[model samples]
Target: MTAWTMSDTGRSAAGGLPAGETAAQLVHRRLRDDIVSMRRRPGDVIFEKEIALEARVSRTPVREALLRLADEKLIEIVPKSGTMVARIPAEILPEIIVARAALEAVTVRAAAESARGSDIAGLRAIIERQRETLATGDIDGFHATDEVMHRAIAEAGRLPGLWSMIVQIKVQLDRYRRLTLPQPHRMERALAEHEAIIDAIAGRDAETAAAAMDRHLDGLRVSLAPIRDLNPDYFSGDVGAVYDRWAGEMA
Candidate 1:
């Protein structure tokens, strides 16, 4: 029998849940992080009973959390077949990149116009943290800092809503990206691209910042083909299958 409790996590520690966080909310956050970070893994079986036992929570909250994740498409619950983490959607990746690149360019341009010296410094700090994570070969840690770098630019522009929207749309992209990070010189190249964006923003060059952001995001769109070829099972089938699944859901 497992003796560990949910309090072991920082947010829901023995001290108590943060503000309005319920057990369901806490469970949802943990499971979502596991899914997005690829700790749970694509197509891996996810038993609610096991998760509830590990969290020491009642099945009600666990059910609620799983339902929420299903809504996010992080986990797909099949009729009579149980649930598994959703595979990355290769067909929609480029569409997502196009949308994200446009929105991100807006944010970086705004950041160039509005960012103070302190904001630039904060972004530099995040990149520096990424530098450390890369040196240690810590892919997840490096990716977390990469998120901070992008979100920092959005926040620096006072457009946190844009970042919030991006977060919602990027979870699928993230699963694919985590795979890309392990490729040769990938993390190093990403760090360099981040530096270029910061330089443009620090110089208060909005056009240059947007262009740099474009080049940065475009790299992912370009990497999709090679990475998908290498990890075919990690992605869903081509457009027809992807459309069928989504269409069935909406029916």
Candidate 2:
């Protein structure tokens, strides 16, 4: 188990946030959101003092948050090099996404077969919340609800290990998911996908549920297709070029 160094309560001392906000919490939220939302691009170095100044908080919380981010494999802490954002091997990401599709297919199938009336109700509630979030155009709320919806399916399957593994893998591709959402109709498409999967699971149609989940994962490739063409310079290293070469070879 990776030790989370920041104690639940000890995380608050570094910055002077409002009366209700602790420095640690503020730092953690800011850094985590920045990384997930791709605002802190991969390979960006985060200086505690700079973040503290920007956040209007103290260095303590920022340090604690950095520690936590390191644990999550979202950042690297080097004694002499400072803290750098994590840069996953972009070329291998496609393979990882394929693995994710396989795992989710199994998980959703199991969930569909095992889900009870109560479980179906729970999933419905999450869908309702997602609809509300969409109606309000609350990206954060929709993101949070998306998590709840996915977890609910895993829980219904009674597979904690599978759920944990999927989460770990999904986090690796989260940068893509975050970026995909900003594209036109991405949110609407995602909502439709979610509805299809949830409906299948609710109906206890294991095959249908698994197929829906697979389709959802496959959509990722479609989303990434245009990105590679429009922003070739933005992606670093040979990763982007390599992918382009792979496509040419396949063709």
Candidate 3:
């Protein structure tokens, strides 16, 4: 696991905030991105002293940022044990996916009915950029573009606020998606699904577009199984039982 630090270039890759961004905001964005991208894996301790040193700021700002992240449930601050990245709770995943699918399905259907030719072209351009990112094996870049593409659909539907809601709901799902990104051909398959959804929307077929979105989200549910199997420690919920069984077997 590579340690993520603020760049010497004075610009961090938390999607490149404006010049006036505060140190606390910068710290929050960098750490949040690292957590979501799995660069800071679940259960990994987050030391305020180290982060403050790396960011060239005092521990006060770092502590403030960590408190914000804790509110988002991205990191847990134990009373005496310190802070660690929060594990994905296995039980809530289905609920998150279901909520996303419902909202996104409604969004895509609206996009199909209301999107202009320019909107369709813009989406196609995003897909092309995703291809370029895939060719270069930039998973992080691909993920960024993936987010842009979905947000574009919401904007096309004239429901830009829905994108914000989706963003909040998908935080956990984003972590799980990052976990699955290294699997063979996952990005390629996701691109194909995106193309299908775009085609349906471009054709002005609301039913098809909604169904395509649902199917795409369904694939996310399927992807979780293998990731859980590979990284049993990165998830919560049944982990205690699993550990207990392992201990019994060893005994």
Candidate 4:
């Protein structure tokens, strides 16, 4: 058995669960992160034997981890064929974008209205880091910074639930964004959008901040439109099939 100990985050040491639970939470987080970050992109086949051998755990725990991932929509558990990373629908893109736009707009507006000097300082610090990443042409770092910046805004807004929703949608949006990351001037344009958002918030102009966020989201959709049109296969078709399966329950 793997030695159990508390992780840095104070999670249940190695396994992060009861000694008799038979599954390691750390292993689950690792596997979940891999799929959510698109390291395991949509439609990639996942073999239980392979995962079990790699995690050094039994297939039972690996299966447990996979079930958790499927529940999060990061991976799909196909009947008999095995679990694969989910290929979400293109429609989910716009839906997520819309949700992000609304929530982020509200977040920024709230941040502007209620932010303390320290909150503003923290946001500025994050933006400066984002600027440095862009200057260094660190594409992955920029993505990381971008994720942090938005989360900061949501946090400053004091709406943790809304922030959680953003986290969920971001997993899907990020895959599309990565496809457009190589486009010429994309980073510069993204920087400009971030600057506009920050400036409006700093100026304490809620309307301007909300409008700026909407524009940013609209631009994201525009940039991805061509790529989305070109690559229809990037998302999973299983989403619809799953929907059909659950439609009766939903109805």
Candidate 5:
């Protein structure tokens, strides 16, 4: 398990915050990012006091932030055992892939119809940066760019609100994606898929763009088995049962 620590600089990982952002909101954002990025790994315990000390805030805010994370299913707060980052359960991957594929396919189709030349240029610029990150072996940078690329598609499609909803649901999927980042040829394959999607959109072929998005998302499903094999302890074999037990205990 990885240890959690606050930066001495006191800046949020999500960058500059708007005015009047509460301590709980800052803590929640930082912790959520850390958990998704695997800086705080599955099953790692989180102490409110330690987090409070690091964030230079009261335990009240830490507790409030944790409850918010719990609502997102990003972390589990056990009655006696305290809080821990939630494991990336294998059972939910298929569902998440399906949902994301449906939403993103629609998004790309819309983008093919609505995206301006500048939007396409911006996406290509991001891909270029992604290529640079791959060459430099900056896995984190590549992943960050990957997210921006997808969000750019949503923005181009005039679905920024839908993108927010996708962000909420893709937290676990993001973790799974992170797990596959270091795999052999994975980044290259993803880059190729992204290019295909971009090409279809640039050509204003809505059908092709949707097809490409579906194919790209389906690739995520293909990687799940290999990921489970690689990190057996990181997923629940019986996810429903586990969730039921957690809900019962919480109730």
Candidate 6:
């Protein structure tokens, strides 16, 4: 895990405070970013006083921040003991994957029908940028650029709203996907998959583009067993919460 310091805690997510953003919000963003990026690994203890001191704020705001993180399940708050970073709820990942794949496949299919020369050019440009970023060993930048590729595809398909929906559903999945970056050839294979999808879209083959996209997204689903096995500590053992959440969604 990457180490963060007290000095790093004072700054808000974007270098400075945005209008009306409070101390608690800033601290929450800092902690959330650290947790999601695996800088603060699963089961790492988080103390209110330490966080308060780091942010140069009273414990009230820090406590509030921690509570918010708990609500997101990014951190677990133990009433008597202490708070700790939450493990990945591996149970929910399959459902998340299914939702994303279904949505993205539709978007890619639509993009194949709607794609213009400019759209194709823009996607190719993103691919070039991803390649350049990956070459520099900036895996995070490469992954970010890869997301732009998906967003561009959604926009090209005239279904930009669906991309926002995708973003909303991907919060937990993002943390899991971040772990996949350093795996040998993971990023390369993803890039190749993107290329295949773009090729099909460029050819105006809607069905082929959708199939390529399904295959691309399915890669993450297939990765679960190996990734979970390799990093058992990173995942939650109890899957009941996932089943409960799904049932609640239906009700």
Off by over 4 Å in 5: 1-18, 239-251
| Clash pairs, model 6 backbone | none
lDDT of 6 at 98: 83
lDDT over C-alpha atoms for residue 9 of model 1: 43
Please give each candidate's TM-score.
0.89, 0.75, 0.88, 0.79, 0.87, 0.84
* Model 6: how far residue 228 lies from native, Å: 1.2
Pick by lDDT: 1 or 4, better one: 1
> Residue 141, candidate 3: how far off, in angstroms?
1.1
TM-score of 6: 0.84
Q: How many pairs collide in each candidate, listed in order?
A: 0, 2, 0, 6, 0, 0
Model 3 poorest 10 in a row by lDDT: 242-251
RMSD after Cα superposition, model 4: 6.7
Once model 3 is optimally superposed onto the true structure by TM-score, how far is the C-alpha of residue 74 displaced, in angstroms?
Answer: 1.0
The candidate, 4 or 6, that scores higher on lDDT is 6
* CA lDDT scores, all candidates in order: 0.84, 0.75, 0.86, 0.74, 0.83, 0.84
Worst 10 residues of 1 by lDDT: 1-10
Give candidate 6's whole-model lDDT.
Answer: 0.84
TM-score for candidate 4, please give it: 0.79
**Model 4 misplaced stretches (Cα beyond 4 Å):** 1-24, 236-251
lDDT of 3 by residue, 1-251 (tens): 34444454165566354498877887898899889988899999988999887777778879999999999989999999999999988767777887898899888999999999999999999999999999999999999999999999998898898889999999988999998878999999899999999999999999999998888888777676677889998998884554444335434
Candidate 3 is scored at a TM of: 0.88
RMSD to the native, candidate 5?
6.1
